[model samples]
Target: MTKELETKGAAIQGADAGKYELSEEQKAHQQERILKQVAKELQLPLTKVKASVSLLDEGNTIPFIARYRKEMTGELDETQLRDIEERLQYLRNLEDRKLEVIRLIDEQGKLTDELRVAIEQAVKLQEVEDLYRPYRQKRKTRASVAKERGLEPLAIWIMTQPRQGSLEQEAAKYMDEDKQVHTSEDAVQGAMDIIAENLADDAKIRAWVRKYTQDQGIIATEAKDSEQESVYEMYYSYQEPVRKLPPHRTLAINRGEREEVLKVRLEVPAERIHDYIAKQIVKGESIVKSTLLLVIEDAYKRLIAPSIEREVRGELTEKAEEHAIRIFAENLRNLLLQAPIKGQVVLGVDPAFRTGCKLAIVDETGKMLYIDVVYPTPPNNKVAEAEAKVKAAIEKYGVQLIVIGNGTASRETEQFIADLIAKLKGRGLRYLIVNEAGASVYSASKLAQEEFPKLDVAERSAISIARRLQDPLAELVKIEPKAIGVGQYQHDVAQKHLDESLKAVVESAVNHVGVDLNTASPSLLSYVSGINGTIAKNIVKYREENGKFKDRKQLQKVPRLGAKTFEQCVGFMRISEGVSPLDNTPIHPESYEVVDRLFRELRLELDQLGSKGLKDKLQHADAEALATKLNVGVPTLRDILDSLQKPGRDPREELPLPIFRTDVLQIEDLTPGMQLQGTVRNVIDFGAFVDIGIKNDGLVHISQLSDTFVKHPMDVVSVGDTVTAWVLNVDLKKGRVGLTMKNPNKKQ
Candidate 1:
């Protein structure tokens, strides 16, 4: 490890010798400062943050450090560890930008000691860019042309407020026809232009003005064509303080601007900015005072105002994007970790209009046993035939649950299924509207092709929908997360940033509920800690060639899965029937000896691991004294005790289950103040869209989320929550249903 770091250090030195003046020692000190700053920012102890950063730098994954290296990191979770890692990368990038900007200025022969210190001390990329703006290269402008015509000295003289001479007379001495200074007035105008540009470029002045604008500016938007109707109708003639704008509104306004439906601009008070600039540049009483005043106004109106407006807008958009990504990540995490509907025979239906509806039946193990196509809606109108086919399939397969995709013609299909269920009342048949957001995307993917080569696209979609109900995490991992449709304005945000954030959420969810090693597909196994796509496929192939793995140690036999991969992923992959019972729990294999010692101290045999007597014994055991005796920390010992209590326990079982319906309702069936049970389909920034066995999903706005104040909709409900709500309003023309969780008429 030392040799590898030394080689890396040499490579950095060889690459950066000419571009930066800082030595290796100085760079190390700067890095140390950054680490301390990150610790302070996160309100974490310096020691834990430092140790976690070191582990990350050593190529250890976040899941590995979080699970296995608790003693070194003070038991920090994956969220905290990932935050430190991201902050570290950001600070390093900031340092690199500083060095590059310094090099650029030095190449221009304009480096000063004060400017160098300021650049090095900057904490944000915006501050560094503000510092570098003065020396940055520019195309030919009014200021540059004036500098070419020998008016820079005149501008500098006016800036000093020399009281001895007339400004126009001094400017006349520099006028020359050959250099395009045609007259005294022209030369004076050129000098003021130069002064205006300089005032515009001042780093300190720009910073002050930026802060003032952001704090005091009003973001105003107006409809470009007032006659045209749009979804952004509320924003047609809107003005709001920049500081008070919500993230969802910001994204909406940005989209409106991008689509050319509205024109948006930052409105700052001009006189205040002009006074601030004049106070900085113009002195008490001089002939050039008036000229300086004119320059300040021109500088602000022409150059600084437009530039600052763009910067402020960009900053707000960046913040809004970050907030949107955070909300999406949280929603995706909750949706992925939803409890699986296990041990049920399910029938999947993919609804369509022109094409026939696709149906697939899967047993308790999620294996497709039968598939067919039926047309029940639209032009074909074969309702009786479709009902007969579905009924036969359900009876033949003993399907108790029907999973219908909420896509085109879904309500019609649901009504037909509801009628069928009513006829076959004694069979205990129920239906659920499954979120099929990414099912089509997954069906068209290369992985889907590899998994179902003989099935068509729609057939694969039906299977995916069924499997999603059986196991959400395993099936959703096969598709990209952004296509899940739980976020607002997902398309407007930066795609790469959104993808990276959602990927981390998926990783956290996957590690939280360990995968079953023998039953997991390669698509699901690839998400395990330290297991990439290639290694996951290799494990599956090895499992196919040899039989089911009877022990966790058998992972070592798979090609490309070395000691490091095994150590990282073994804790997150479970073998239910493995030789050692600990292999099925969340405890790492390295701590098996500690577990053995624990069992020895408890006087329990290996075969008596999950018995009620063993659970009772562990319930009364002294964890603190046992930890001291076993040479392990309390956290590790507590984790071991937890594992022993419930072997192969899934954490998702603690969450609420999906709502199922025996009858279907339509949009016309909804009435104001009607109470109904529903399932949360998607939770966004403003509200949650709920599936209430209706054609149009109901919207529960953030205001109606609770009896008290709700900061966000997710705080009140989550995706897949079984909630009871009252209808607030209904717009039949628009097909929109408004529901509220707070029933005001009912007593508390």
Candidate 2:
């Protein structure tokens, strides 16, 4: 080695004397290059990918774009959009570290052309370390001590194989007593150890090992022999390759290791690894090749092996988390998109005993009509009075359906309604047990209090129950989805992640079912496109001050609701008396000109296009002719025509009626294997929860949801879906109701 090289290496070990920094511009350039490569890998348009990155950098939520900005994103779904967002964050972080590594090497005056090229091409931190391995500082090991003792020349001679004598004969020259040079064998062995340690710590060797292990590593765990009946029992005899292991199994194994219930180790086939490392070391038969081989073996044993094991395990765990989160987000979306049961005159009952059942009636629009109290269950002993009160309310309010809250004494209240129905032999009267998980929370909320100041807290709860049945999307938005009690281990997951995911579900559902601009509450309006809480409140206040909105143009008159907000949200906000009928449909105002031209081409007025016969004729019309005339697609033409036919049709009206039972009050009344009609309240990764007219919600675990294996519960049932479930087990003390959907014939 040269004297200059020695000095630079010393400076690197001492620090302060050698350190460099890159400019911000240099870092940004590197980031841009990396992003371009990622875009290529994903096969996304560069402009679109960059736009998504820019949005993420500014902390814009994904749900906002997926629902409102169809034109800007080319209508990317939530999954594709989120993938881009996650990748951008990772690439940015990698670029930052690259800049730091470059500066450190330049300061040490050790930045060679080869090193620079390696660092520039490195895509991960492990790759960067591999390039830096030869330059890093080291302690006074046997290799450095040998070099100091003047034995390095002999070692180098052997490594080079430069037409010399045998290795021992060559080493004799450096074996002077004054230098404390030992036997040729001892000197050569010490030299080999130094080389081995150096190779082991080399960044290149570590990176290679990591890649190999990630592809071939097997994670095995054995129980400690003490906790056989513990949480880790399933994983006690587990051994599986990292890549092949299922996500749930990975999480279970990791949790077991965290609790110290299992001893875990990652293993790879030895012969294959040894052969691969040998080839890298012995590229050709030079004297250095022999030393490099020893180094490779030493590195694997001492440094590379252990580090690679941990990295492989960590990567596996991260993959598991990503998979689990994706499943959860999907299920949440389906649950939120569940069809709402609209336009029903509902009688909401918040069932109780000592406090008596609180009943409130709501009209088809979810506005509270009347409030009353009745002791339907024990202690009051007023069954006849309760029956009379219910009948009178139903008759007076012209209630079509009864919505009983799924809370305390719910089944008893359901039975009371059943008896009242039989006594009156009423027509068009059906009672539903609503999933009232978060009703109590909503009743005591500040928003509820502000909306109904004159009514008691119990009465507000009844109103919430009625509103849920009338428009689930609007009312459910007031409470947190996790608190709505539909998910599994919701509390155990990351709170911010869960909240953001669930919020996206709610927003998507709200937009899917267009809101009534005239009658929607501020809370419901807030979820609409371009309308925030402040704007929603302003809209409601303006409507109250003035009259109902007669057209989309009136939205701009609301305070703080500008033209841009109106443009984005107006199409989603339906007006029955709008000047342009298209405003009531999901078709954007930007497409109104095209729609009007189509109407003119058909030789029909806009009003004449509202019938199914006219729509069918328009849909069958040639797309090529329309494209030639209006410069639009057959698809776009058809879409526009359909929107015109049924302007402001409530998509919720197409869904099945929510079935609620007026019998089977308690767990004691439920028998194992008994089939019952129930409504699915929430869906999670593990299972779906069904409200079977009982205070306790029944769990339909994913395994029981289908005869075949179900990866997720949402695949079977969604929120607000009426399903038939069989009672598997009923534990009243624990308040557990286990239900199953495994049998197709199980439903009543």
Candidate 3:
């Protein structure tokens, strides 16, 4: 370490430094050390990481880097690159604080080697205070003002054990009527107050107490009598150990305290803490020890206790917020990955009033087949005509499913479909009520307008409803994920953080399901590996201009799509009838040579190996055969074989189908204790909203989600999940339905 670093370390150790305090220099050096450590962890060359850090500190966005800096970061993915960016910002903030602290200490003219080292090594604000304790300003303190009266020698003599046998006799030598020390008892009492105040402000003692209180404190709160019947009634008599409180309970308690519904207290056993402080300060003397103990007690009661309590509460709140965010992130990942119900011919209905009902027919693959309008509701007064028109279209197009947008006149439209299905009971068909949260937004979108310029906005909405059922991942990706309504306090949370988190969810979902290179829209394709917006457009243009790509090699011809992009993304882009079988599986195209060698060694052709039986054979194949023939590990070869057997099978299909209802029920019709099957529409931190065929959704709070305590609503129910919940409370006036997931008959 340099002299500056050594000096900082000493300051941190609380060693007495000479008149020149080294605080300022130490803090600056400490910041430099943190930056170096962060840069090294990111595995970037020092220069490159430092340059990026400087740019970020000046305020640049992550999207700017992911798009523009291909060569700068060795093309790091968005996630890894953003992690480095966040850490850089944090370190820079720490550096700015260090500079400010150092400047303040230097101005005090108390800079020393030990003080400098302490400032440099300080990891937290608390540590900084402990080091600065000895030098901090004192107000009209008893000890300092007493010293001004020329009582230092007497105070020191008493503290050091006076040479005289009696402290009173020694104290009388310094006492005078002008100094206001008339009696020995009065003089001793005044001296004891000075000692007590000094002991209370001791930096080392305060630091140890702060740490102990944080580890052992319990935040206790009781409801005020006036607010005893409020929403926070349960928390009126609440007291929970800081470390043991669950995330939801912590948030609830804090919210209660903030609203003044509870009187909160942060308590710790102070007796044990006082004993520890006494050991450090009042070493061994009967008279001095008695005075020191009295001083320590006064100091704690007057100052230290209150400060420590506030700090502990702040730390607990921060910890709770962190845990809540982590839970939100996990739930979002699973909700986004819910299965896409594929390959169904659907009749989409966007119900309306003056415009009647806009109907659009889409093929099994989501291609628009036809569009029309029918008045199925009031003002038309011709229900017969509307019914005939819908039946004829369904028959003509062979529509296997009916998707009604949950918007205006949706209940009436749903009734029409249910009646139609009842009349044609022998016809194999199903109907679903699709959430239209962002359907209108998507219809007005530039991308949607470009895809359907000739169709009216109403018809575009119908098409969206149909497509959402066919592939929820692809359709939902067109709109911002936040607009999809699956987060808790999303708007209140950091906007940039929410966007990044949701984007990760979308990307992970898209890749998990895989995509068809030729048929996928550019919006969907952009999420695929190696395929950005420009290249995705190019791939679409190439397909439209020259027909479908016959093999993976043809992808190289797309504008601006290079060899490196192909290597990262080709295996994830599936082709239904490509020239090679591996083109349809997740096994990268580069691994084709290895598969071919394995095939030859087994005396089998690629066509014969496509059978399901071949998967079993490959699963049990010897490790030595794989190693000798393919020059790869058995594990790698086995993974490749498994991918080949499935050949683009979506992982999401393993989940249950989204629930679709035929009849709509109102809040008034729902009674307390009534059980109903509902589909989960969206998940938030506090609860999950279930669509029970009513225009409004019912809420199942985290506590009501299960008999056992749920950390999050998604722990038991996910987006599109069908759950059986009982109505716990129904407020018709407010149009609110409170539900419970736990079975009512089950024993507690």
Best candidate, TM-score:
1
Q: Which residue pairs show backbone clashes in model 2?
A: 130-203, 130-204, 159-287, 159-288, 160-287, 196-295, 200-299, 411-665, 432-660
lDDT of each: 0.88, 0.73, 0.73
Q: List model 1 lDDT by residue over 1-748, tens digit each.
A: 1111222222223354565756899988987999999999999999999999999987788988987888899999998998999788777777777777777788788999999999999988778888888898999999999999999998888889877778778878988989989888988999888988888899889999999999999999999998898998998899999989888899999999999999998999999989888788777888778878888889999999999999888888888988899988888998899999999999999999889789999999999999999998888989889989998998898998999998988888888888889999899999888889999999999999998999999999999999889999999999999999888789999888899899989988998899999999998888888999999999999899998998898999999999988988988889999888888999998898998888888889878878999999999989999999999998888888988899989999999888889887878888899999998878888889988877878999999998899988878887778899999999999999999999868797
Model 2: worst 10 consecutive residues (lDDT sum): 1-10
Which is the winner by TM-score between candidate 1 and candidate 2?
Answer: 1
* Candidate 3 off by > 4 Å: 1-245, 249-322, 350-358, 370-389, 407-413, 444-446, 453-460, 530-535, 541-546, 559-564, 623-625, 663-678, 682-717, 722-748
Which candidate has the highest lDDT of all?
1
TM-score of each: 0.96, 0.73, 0.66
lDDT of 2 by residue, 264-333 (tens): 9888886677678777656566535655666666667666688677767666665666556556555555
Ranking by TM-score: 1, 2, 3
2 against 3, candidate with superior TM-score:
2
lDDT of 3 by residue, 672-740 (tens): 889998888777668889988776789998888887778756667777788999999988887888989
State residue 621's C-alpha deviation in candidate 2, in Å: 3.4
Instruction: Superpose all Cα atoms of candidate 2 onto the true structure and report the RMSD in Å to 1 decimal.
Output: 8.1
